[model samples]
Target: MSLQVRIMTPDRIFLNEEAEEIILPTNTGQMGVLKNHAPLITALDIGVMLIRSKNEWTPLALMGGFALVKQNQVTVLVNEAESAETIDPNEVENSFTIAKTKLEQAEGQKQKVEANFVFKRERARYQVIKQAKKM
Candidate 1:
């Protein structure tokens, strides 16, 4: 049996399908869920979410959110998400560089906080590209 996985964003549902395994970047660390694994809920971080089905892996860059696993079903609700296949490597690298610069030049606390979020998002996208290349 496979797990019913659903990934959603604010605007709409991003993915709805079956997956052999699901990996989420939780606040504590990466958590892997399989069919009939467990019942739990956890906070997710800005990172990559990997889904494996039929020996193929798909990577998605996710922003901060939460995940719930119950009854062999996994639901991921995130603020934003992007598929690794759709990301432009050069664009991601450029955004990462720009975000780093903005973070460094951010003077006020609010600016720093916003810039940090952007930096984290870009970093996750970069990591997603790298991770997808391996698969």
Candidate 2:
């Protein structure tokens, strides 16, 4: 049997399907989930989430949130999520470059934190697009 995966944002449900495997970017690190995996909860980071179904991998840019895995069901609730197909590579590349610059030039602690957050978010999007192109 496959795992039931559901990804949601505040506005709407991003994905509701079955995936053979899932790799989540958690606060600790990357965590892999599969069918019949033990129940657990994890805090997601601003990074890429990979879902594998039918031996094909799909990537999604996921913002910070929490995930719950129980009884072969994986539920992800994030602040924002974007599929690679919906993102523009050119726009993401430009934003990633700008965010990197801002992060490097940030002075105060608050500015540094904010810049870092933006940088990570853009970087995640950039990574998702890059991964998609490779597939």
Q: For residues 53-82, what per-residue lDDT tens digits would candidate 2 score against the true structure?
A: 999999999999999999999999999999
Off by over 4 Å in 2: none
Per-prediction TM-score: 0.91, 0.99
Please, what is the whole-model Cα lDDT of each candidate in the order they appear? 0.93, 0.97
Question: What TM-score number comes out for model 2?
Answer: 0.99
Per-residue lDDT for 32 in model 2? 97
Model 2 clash pairs are none
What local lDDT does model 1 show for residue 43?
Answer: 98
